[model samples]
Target: MISEPFANKKTWVHSLDPRLRVCTAFFLSCLFAITNQPVLAACALIASALLLGCSRPPLSALLRRLAGVNLFILFLWCSVPFFTPGTPIAKFGPLTCTQEGLDLVWLVTLKANAITLLLIACIGTMSASLLGHALQALRLPDKFVYLLLFTYRSLFVLADEWQRLQTALRLRGFVAGTNLHTYRTVGYLFGLTLTRSLDRAQRIHQAMLLRGFTGRFPAFVLLRFQRHDFLFAILTALFLIFLLFFWNNPFFP
Candidate 1:
């Protein structure tokens, strides 16, 4: 459900041409990755928020997704500072955090948030199939594009299979715990799931063959670019370029 929310939303971001959106997201991602300055990183994060606002996805869902991402980021924040070497800022027993480590943590957090926000706004506002086609349009390798397409399609199928397995287990009076029986049952479940997945893959391949699915995916819809799409892409690029230029200006030096 969360995966395909883009199809239901009719915002300005969703209205932009997917090709331009993909390009803009790619450029922004590169920009975010290369920048090391904390101020520039924060700016990137702000830009992501602004983009998300324009897309207008459900706020609660957005927060939930962001919270899940932050869990991993929290781990990085906790562990990264302990290993990085620099001027010690705080001591906890034998372990201490360096100023450089603190800076690294902040940079990682900012970059993560910025990229996540940009993706939700830029690429997440469009259907996966269309996005795949847009990638193809951009001359990305067909194998990579199709890999993305198949992966997206199969995730839901795998999730459904997992849910069914859980339901069956529940109906069979399965009670999960840290006991030996629970562990053995889980092992069986994993093995069975893998077997079923292999079977499903074979069946899917046969079905595709019957339907004349060549290695290339047929275009379902033509992508059209409007004046607004170009305008949006241009404006976004200009703003990012300005920020990149400003970050290197002598004021900060």
Candidate 2:
């Protein structure tokens, strides 16, 4: 079991088949992309929030994982009103904030937040191996899937090494502060990480070849299509049909 928030075993989300999660996430994403109303978007966000809580992933884990992205979201929101010009809701010389711009800001921000949550809801509960297996079963391109698998494995491996490098930096009084020297140091570290990642990739390919790695990866395990999956699929189809119709309805603004 994954010890992290998304790696839980208790929630209904964890119990769900991987394919269901993928479909649900993908469907919600499509819906979010096509719809542009605040209330409707809020509904989608609430649905995602429900899944997040239902999955029982750690709140702290979600917050931490989303921290860097949310920081950017905050910066984006702050800049929108100033740079986006429209009929003035408020005016400060050259900076006239418009109602449309503010509305647009909230619309994008909420939808983006919902999108992130929806993805986290899927990935947090799934192992990369399981996801790869799902891709294979779904008939995704074999070459790309193998590439994804190798990339996923390398990510964790490199993450461990990166942590070690960070520790070493700290031990030698390499503070993570903004300075020309620090930026240069980090740039060098990034370059080294990429180099090491390539080396590891080469080693893995050699090892796989030695172990009789063929042109194509072995087929993924089949997940049984349970009654629950059918139900979910049906319900989701209905929900999406309704959502699309409603989005197109004149009363839906």
Candidate 3:
């Protein structure tokens, strides 16, 4: 439920080359995965938090909106012990899940969440158009690229329509109750939304074809990077190296 700060005005991160942003995100994810010690991963997580703080959004905004999904991320750790087993740590009335499994749980949870935070940070810092342009420049398949672009574009349209529908329903005093009518109302909304979405997609596709779209999205490189870009990239690499090295290599553990 966290409000998206990604819609912020242009900042330094946004001004960088899209390739740098993408690479930074990938590098952070790798670092998070390589580190398993909770203390070390916690430090990495704190660093990411600081990075977000530097992005200039109020902390309250992220908590009020993003905290719920953040809680779900915390729960992702619950799965590790149920699947992985070794020596016992705590007995939950009778369950025999081990410390090793729980260590894995911490590892998985922190790794996934740290990466998610970075991804969110990047998405907020960079514009969708810039991201599309970057991917296109990377020589991604045109069909897939255009599909993603159009899909994202269509969402705002559909979302606006949905808001209008909700207002209309509210004005008419339509209410859901605990009965068959509730199910019927849900079904009606679903049908209406689906039909509207499909119709809108068809019209958009026809319009694109009319505009000479030959299964390719136009690519425009917006800006280029400088030596500073490499410096930031090297710093990101060093951060990853530090996190990964904090834990003793335990593949043979």
Candidate 4:
């Protein structure tokens, strides 16, 4: 099973309607993505951090996720500074670091972190099944929702099949190494896994058809918008308005 550390939490964030969380995360990400001003990005980042704090995610897990995001940002820092055209601030032999490049990368870093934190707080606190249901409730395309739910289910099946294959290989005294035989064995293992997955998929489809599945899975728990949800919506609206106001008129250089 996929580990969902944040999903089972009883925090206020987890209690909010999944649809509301999804919409909030989407709009916040869009707002953060298009903004080029560092001050606006910084403010957004601070807001996202507060949201994440409300979600009360495990600090260790949050740190791990942030580390992964920053690794990619680190790559951007390495390449973007040298190639962007602007007034040169620093030089290393033929490569020159420009002020514009540094500013651009910094804005990106802030936006990326802010959006990531926001998503982790909002979307990450729900199970994949709940997310799919929320998307369906939000009137997303039926095909897209079906694809997401199916893909998520299929990942577990694939992982199980792969693990069974690995166990078989281990039982047969297979030892991995930097050798042609190991490479061939690994390739054959992947081919067998694919073949088995295809067969399993066919079987599953036939079973679903036998059960009269008409492409729509019913949600067991109906989503209700409570007073808290209304309050959340109001607060989020005010926050967005504040961001917009500051976005146009920054108080700092």
Candidate 2 — which residues are off by over 4 angstroms?
1-4, 162-197, 219-221
lDDT of 1 by residue, 1-253 (tens): 1366645688888888889989888999998988788788888899889878977788777888799989999998889998899999899999999989989999989998999999888888888888999999999999999999888877777777777899999999999999999999999888887778778988999999999988998888788999898789778978887877887777643
Candidate 1 residue spans exceeding 4 A from truth = none
Leading candidate by TM-score? 4
lDDT of 2 by residue, 43-92 (tens): 77887787677777777778886786678878877788777767778878
Candidate 1 — worst ten consecutive residues by lDDT sum?
A: 1-10
Candidate with better TM-score, 1 vs 2: 1
- Top of the candidates by lDDT: 4
Candidate 3's clash total is 4
Score every model by TM-score: 0.89, 0.82, 0.80, 0.95
TM-score of candidate 3 versus the correct structure, residues matched by position:
0.80
Per-residue lDDT, model 4, residue 202, is 95
* Higher-lDDT candidate of 2 and 4: 4
Q: Candidates' lDDT values, in order?
A: 0.86, 0.77, 0.71, 0.92
Q: What is the lDDT for 17 in model 4?
A: 95
Which model is ahead, 2 or 3, in terms of TM-score?
Answer: 2
User: Which pairs clash inside model 3?
Assistant: 1-65, 2-65, 2-66, 6-124
